[model samples]
Target: MIKGIYETHVNVRNLENSNHFYEKVLGLAHAYGQPERGNSFYWIGGERHAMLGLWEKEPAQVQRQHFAFHISLEDMKHAVEYLENKGIATRNFHDDDTGELYVFGWMPAVSVYFTDPDGHSLEFIAVLPDEAKPELGLIPWSEWERMHGRGV
Candidate 1:
């Protein structure tokens, strides 16, 4: 069975800047990589965990993309404050007309969207519970067990 995603590779223009942002700003660890291969990698956990990779490319060659991190409401607030303190404002925040945040096109999740210093779109999202039980509606963590299929 497919467990989960181990890594995501992104194209970047400068490894130094991207490394700095992912490490210092995003608080991810610098993992293994090779400049000769035009790739640099980082991870949230350690070597035993999956990683995120950045491949060096021309500025024009780098396409704009969006990535998300599943986080709790408290973490989401902290992340928003952190980004704002770093001078990155939310392009759009809070639930929109469709009871979703940034529900643009195919994206379906309750998310907060902002950009990194390099202008890469970043989203901190919390997916709605599949079954909207009375206690689960808009209640953060009230149904986390159900949402994640945890046995309690």
Candidate 2:
């Protein structure tokens, strides 16, 4: 059987700044990293972690890369507010293909996309419902588990 996720690696331009963002801003702990290797790693929850590696290049070298983290509705709301107050820009999205996409009113698994201080595209998403909820935007994990699978 599968155990669990280990870590996801991402490249950064500034290891120090990325370290600060993941630690102070995201509240993740710095597990271990190698400056000589041009990489920094942050411990997320438990065994799960995220790696930030440093790289050097020109302007066009900055490509758009994005990853999403699942958060609860309340957390999502607070995060949106926090980012907005911090001057982080966020935009709303809608899907035309309801047959394939999930939505949660204004709350349907809301997502915010923005660049980190390093110009990396980072996204936070609250999972949306398979159907549109005009009033509520919360899609419980139980429902998602049934729709997707176990362990999600």
Query: What is each predicted model's overall lDDT from 0 to 1?
Result: 0.64, 0.58
Best by lDDT: 1
Q: Write the per-residue lDDT of candidate 2 for residues 15-108, one digit (tens) a residue.
A: 6776777777766677777777667776655434444434433445557566666666557656656776766765544422222223345544
Q: TM-score for all predictions?
A: 0.67, 0.61
Q: How many backbone clashes does candidate 2 have?
A: 2
- Per-residue lDDT for 1-152 in model 1, tens only? 99988888788888888887788877788878787878878875567577888988888978887787676544654655677687666645553333223322222235667766557788877544344444333432323444557521
User: What local lDDT score does residue 68 receive in model 1, on the 0 to 100 scale?
Assistant: 73
lDDT of 1 at 70: 70
RMSD in angstroms between candidate 1 and the native structure over all alpha carbons: 6.7
Model 2: how far is 6 from its true place, Å? 3.6
What is the overall TM-score of model 2 with all chains considered together? 0.61
Q: How does candidate 2 score on lDDT?
A: 0.58
